[model samples]
Target: MTVQTIPAPAAPLRVTPASPLFLREDEIRRGIELLYFGYTAMIRGADAILEAQGLGRAHHRALYFIARQPGLSVGELIGLLGITKQSLGRVLTELQARALVEQQVGTADRRQRLLRLTKAGAALEARLFGELERSMARAYGEAGQQAVTGFWAVLMGLVPPDDRPRVEALQA
Candidate 1:
């Protein structure tokens, strides 16, 4: 039997350079729309994977952060996610129930709970990240190095000044 191969996607349209009046309302709206749509597209594949596992974006976010810092505390996760304790508690409970995560009492503070991923959790996180990395790599390759740097700068500008340190710490 002959095998069939799907065609590659068409090249993206050429994006116009920003006008001198980039601060105008139309330009700002364009930026906002692009950000919303771009993010939605980027996460679409991961969302499907999460849905198949009976999970949601919040669960994915928790898995990602927990993977990033294996011994992340419950309080620190709440802070990083900027989510309510009740909301996080629900997500963590579900994750633990699925044997995807484990929590241990902090060595220094008996009252504190530190979070870590199970082997299963790590596998799931890696799959999710693979989907994201593929999308990002394609976009970055299309945009090139200079545009990628500018994109990072624009995203950083969106973060509050006080939160910059927390974000910067992740780079280390």
Candidate 2:
């Protein structure tokens, strides 16, 4: 039999005084602006890459999420992407035609069509998404410690508090 090891948890520490930070309004505004700037640059890069392949962001989003949860139903993908049915249909058609994604009927629910990535699709997503991830990481690193952590906090706040549990569960 194979053995497994798990690390023990550390004991809780007592409260301590932290460094004081004077965050001015202008500085906070700049922080928000940097968030916008960073997002725009990242999107521009991803758009160019997708355009080169004659695909769009919608396609990228669809492929990216579906890859994470293979066999996702059309309805489920619709919910995740939060796009109009017509818009999604267009992208799904293109993906299906290219054999990047395949749709199969749900076993119990005949009306539902489940989507999954083919080997080629997963490979393509990895190549494209790898670039996006690296670029984003570099950009955030350049933004320094405060902006990086602050930006994460801001983005996390964008999601509703009620939905946080659901989001955390999914990531878990």
Candidate 3:
């Protein structure tokens, strides 16, 4: 007997907001500009320090997440980074070559490779985090408690729904 297969329907189009809640185009544009500048400034704050070590944003992010969740597996790091395995591999290779990160076989699963920051890595991460904290502290202080909370909410909301669980797990 021959079997027939049905194709899946295409996803529905996204709806644009029509109410007062929608932001003006100019306002939206300004918000985008602000985000760009804010991110640039935030990275610049740590760039000098990272530059001294010949590292970049990818290295910093890997260190940050590994420091945050010690013993995180290589697979988990790749997922959390949202980067290709090749990209992550380069970063991990650099970090490992610099003696900043250590990887060991997982106790529960021998096939899994667990990662941790070495003492040097922790120190570097702390310094990078300190630079970030200086700027973040000032921003949060100026923004006030409510704004700070709102900022976190907005940032969290920007994360993909599918990745929220992984983010929440890290937060916990």
Candidate 4:
């Protein structure tokens, strides 16, 4: 049997402008499709790295947030990740066992556990972030400042108002 290969597109696909009535079904579907495909493409590189290290997206999410806010409490991480305590426990356990993360007792609350990335974890996180940054930077460059701002606005709109503060805190 002969193997067949699909040829890559010769150029990037042209972006279609949203309809004046962006709330139309076609426009809404296009937005959903773009979000899905764009996110998949953006995370593809980081996914490979995670797989090579025997980790998954959950582990990456934990590492990423911990790296962003060292000493983040386990409770806070659970809130941020929107994961069950048991799920977070497993991810944290594996991370600590692999020497990619560490947890310290909270200063004020002895029962609270705070999370931080180990040096190796930081290095790995940086590499993964580098992959994401490159992809986002390229897309942002192509989209220009106004378009990027609009994109951010659209994304922010998708977040529930109650949860916006939690997401905004990441920018701090």
Model 1 clash pairs? none
User: Model 2, residue 70: displacement in angstroms?
Assistant: 1.3
In model 2, the runs with Cα more than 4 Å from the true position are 1-28, 140-150
How would you encode candidate 4's per-residue C-alpha lDDT over 2-44 as one tens digit per residue?
2123222444335887778989999999899999999999999
- Badly placed stretches (over 4 Å) of model 4 are 1-14
What's the C-alpha lDDT at position 121 in model 4? 96
lDDT of each: 0.89, 0.76, 0.83, 0.89
Models 1 onward score TM values of 0.90, 0.74, 0.84, 0.90
Error of 1 at 121 (Å): 0.1
lDDT of 3 by residue, 1-172 (tens): 1212322224322323335754778667766786899888888889999999999999999999999999999988998888999999999999999999999999999999899999999999999998887776666655556666867887788788987788889876
The clash numbers for all candidates, in the given order, read 0, 0, 0, 0
Residue pairs of candidate 3 with colliding backbone atoms = none
Model 2, C-alpha of 152: deviation from truth (Å)? 2.9
What is the TM-score (0 to 1) of candidate 2?
A: 0.74
Candidate 2 overall Cα lDDT vs. reference? 0.76
What is candidate 1's lDDT per residue for 83-108, written digit by digit as tens? 99999999999999999999999999
lDDT of 3: 0.83
- Residue 14 error, candidate 4, Å: 5.6
Better of 3 and 4 by lDDT: 4
Superposed Cα deviation of residue 158, candidate 2 (Å): 1.9
Q: Which candidate, 1 or 2, would have the higher TM-score against the true structure?
A: 1
